[model samples]
Target: MVKKVIRIILLNIFSLFPLDSRKIIFESNSEIKDNSKALFLKILDLGVNSKYKIIWPVENPKECKDAFKEYKNVSFVKKSKSGSSSLLFLYHCCTAKYCFYTHNPLGQRTREGQRKVFLTHGTPIKDTRGMFWPPYENTDIISTSEFAAYLRCKTFGGGDDVVRLLGFPRNDFLFKTDKGTEEYFDKIKKSKFIIWLPTFKRHNISVKRRDFDEDKNSDISILSPGFMEKLNNYLKAKDILLLIKYHPSQNLDYVSLKSYSNIITLTNDQLEKNNVDLYSLMGKSDALITDFSSVYIDYLLVNKPIGFELGDYKSYKNGRGFIVDNPLDFMPGEKIKSPGDLYTFIDNIFSGVDKYEEERIKLRNKMHKYVDGDSSERVLRYFELIN
Candidate 1:
């Protein structure tokens, strides 16, 4: 209660000062990543921030600053915690004329004259708590497709005023082909690249969500040592490199990840340290392997092979239900249930045989109204910020 009051007072106090029309603040869950970072970089790419002040309030100012130190217009401030916007953070948030954020880390709205746009982290597939209810209501939310926009309003529980169907800015990175991205691609040891992204499953353990399972769910550790080695041998022989990017919420220790011949694990810290743009890397990858992660939804733009390793499908559905009734209906890709299935998926990719190509295209058309990689432009044009 005290924290809430303090934040409210600070926001109102900060609102008294005139908002800076040329100032733009970007924020996320205090981590210098996600759609917020994507849009921030997009603004810089336009070569329009020469006179504009760009600020990002983060938990680690030094880390965030270093991530984009090449840009002169960028600055980082300590993020607000509990309710204290660290004074400096509050000042920037209140004064900025435009703000782009994924998570509402500020926790308070100082939108007296400021425009707030919420670039939600990702599309909601499971009944995740933070994805729905509150904060999202009445905020300008970015979505890729009309179906996604509808899903956002339904899951996020916001009115028509909340949605902007101009597509996600990060997906634009996937469409890019630059020398920088090419260099990153060249760093890979194998000729072929594939990425696997697993969704966070916090609620799968005797959790609480309406209609979700209360009992503990089955464990889904599909990466046994034997399985990893076997998969690694196949990847080595096939000249395919597999990159597994774990969710921040999911602990890597549990996986007992080992150094494999043709497999590598990527973490948020590793990506940040290298200043690598994730979606840019994804754009160049050959194929994708994911389980209930919204990253797969965005990968639809790549129009490549995708495989869903739903080892614990039943438990996951019963423990943490999907937003859509028939999740498989939306999944237009190979289904991997065992080692044999996974190997087959990889083999098909190597052979340039896509079984679900038609289904993927159909679903892609159904989900994405715009297939072109100009979503970032759409967003800027919608706001009249660009010609």
Candidate 2:
């Protein structure tokens, strides 16, 4: 009883501050740029006709601030030092009639507000838990997959009416020939491209740094010298160019590996270089290797081999979390559990039997049905648009 009271008091204390305060005070320093801003910019472009103003309140709003450059009405309001990020959302729920969001576990009051439509921001993994999309007593959930919707219902105890299985808006380019695929395919047809998109799991170093710091490295050993060595070796061994996509907050000194002609680092700004959308990178890659990133689920659309690095799966589940029906069911090519296992898996991808294409396509079809390049249109229409 005392603990519950303390929690309530803490919540009230947090609610008193500005949104930027909570985020700026807690977010890690390794942030390269706000990728979510880039994503929301895409959203603004698609929804330019809509009058419902889009508000993005992030700690580092510099990169995302420009996402609204094309649109006049889109607003970027940085929360004052006293406001909390979660509380800011809660406050906005009362005022903003409609809000589109990505990640916010504390988003409960949206049910009472006009509407809060969510875009699945990051790739989900197998073992993720209640944090991704919390099962609130009352709230509408916009999910990226039927699997995700089902998981929210089954795992977190959310009801059927609360879950909306809309496909991810970001992947619209993957299905659209003009938006991303034509350009992406043009690149892949020339050379082998391996996109190393690992999860933010401490084991994989994909989880937000703030969350990991709270635990103080008790479970996962994030980014050891040995791990860096393995990655360097991977860079050297193959002609395949690696597209290293880190989490928004992760800061891998990709410059250290840039000496190798086969390695390249992908930043949010770099998206403009080849007009590459992230999903297109996945679609055009020769093979997809990830720790727990759900991007594999999307990459499966290309019918390529999907590899899993579970070197610290046990530790990650204990520390961060996972998001799938069965953790192992989603891993396609090989379930690697150690440094040596990762090496072997890479060897097999380059030299072994390439037999994961069929399963990859089958799963991609089952998991993703609405990859018709109309996801953005559908999302905009759901909010009431002409096209």
Candidate 3:
């Protein structure tokens, strides 16, 4: 309470500035109003010093204004300026009082006088798979998780001196009032939901979003037809509701999976229609099934069972691989490569033959050490805009 009050006071003071020179900007080519990015913008808006100003760059004003009409302190920038003019325009824009980056290279390239903070928003950045890009210098890297920070350093080669362990404010949703941890448990107590979160396989061309044309050449992960069939059977036999959740950017068409009564294919349309809270969805599930996504870490909050779909383990590792201290021993939960194998594993657990929650709890404890609900508050404190 006291801390929040302090922040509010400081923000009021910052907002009182007469000039627009105290602006903080978030730059991205993607839709700034999208759910993934919007969540971050929303949090920052909460601590926005009304006077300091916040801006978003949009290639098209009509589109951005139409989408973000509800949000104040957001403006569009059209770089009608070309060639050296474009560079100059970008450089001039970066001269904000403070600029926050969700990823790398945008502001770091030429943010000469701006107070820049690199905020990593997603979990896929750790591996060299799918859309891996070379790492470069950053101002100060704000990490959502310690493991994420470790992976950043190990793969990107940085040390603690430059990295700040401030969790992603967007994740504050996981701990929000009325719809957070407690609310999640209340809803989950009623149903047996299973989340199947798989990374895009190398040849899964359909997984790429339609907007991202550059990813048309991507490959899908190794799939075992027999395994998929067997897993489908298990869902049918148990009368369990199976939810397949993939990356948001992945252009996955889950319409085919609807043929199965027990299987629920989550598509982008479904995501937008339901306005589902992922943390709540994961919380409601009995167990989680995933590949390399960091969703499992968040699911740990519910102390639910987590399993890996490693059917294409070797190939995935080869493409966008991991450096797990031990593939089998380092990670938490059981590893099942084949759907048939996963069926047997699920059967055993559902039969009340194995207590998987215990291990899930321990793993959750390890992964969650850095993720208290107060991470966003920590991040806000970093600006010293508020105490």
**Number of the top lDDT candidate:** 1
Ranking by lDDT: 1, 3, 2
Q: Return the TM-score for candidate 1, rounded to 2 decimals.
A: 0.90
TM-score, prediction 3: 0.71
lDDT, model 1: 0.75
lDDT of 2 by residue, 1-387 (tens): 875665455555544443321121101111212223334445556565254455556555655457446675554444433334444444543355444555543332423434544444544554345444445533555565676567545645555676666566656555544455476556544246677776543323443443332343322243354565566567566655666665543444421223235555565546655656676556566777777766776666556677786666665566555555377766668776666766666676667457666666666666776655555556556655434
Q: Which ten residues in a row have the lowest lDDT in candidate 1?
A: 210-219
* Per-residue lDDT of candidate 1, residues 1-387 (tens digit): 988788678878987888788887888767667887677767888865776888888787897677678887888988643333578888887788778877673323636556778777777666664544474333577887778777666676555566778878788888886565577667874888898887754423323433324322322367787778888999999999998877776545555446687898877777655656788888888999998888888889889989998886777788757888899988989888988889999899889988898999988776777887788778777766677
TM-scores, one per candidate: 0.90, 0.68, 0.71
* Candidate that scores best on TM-score: 1
Total colliding residue pairs, candidate 3:
15
Pick out the ten consecutive residues of candidate 2 with the lowest summed lDDT.
21-30
Model 2 local distance difference test score: 0.53
lDDT by residue (tens digit), candidate 3, 79-152: 42121113322543445656665533344333344455666555433253333233444666766556666765
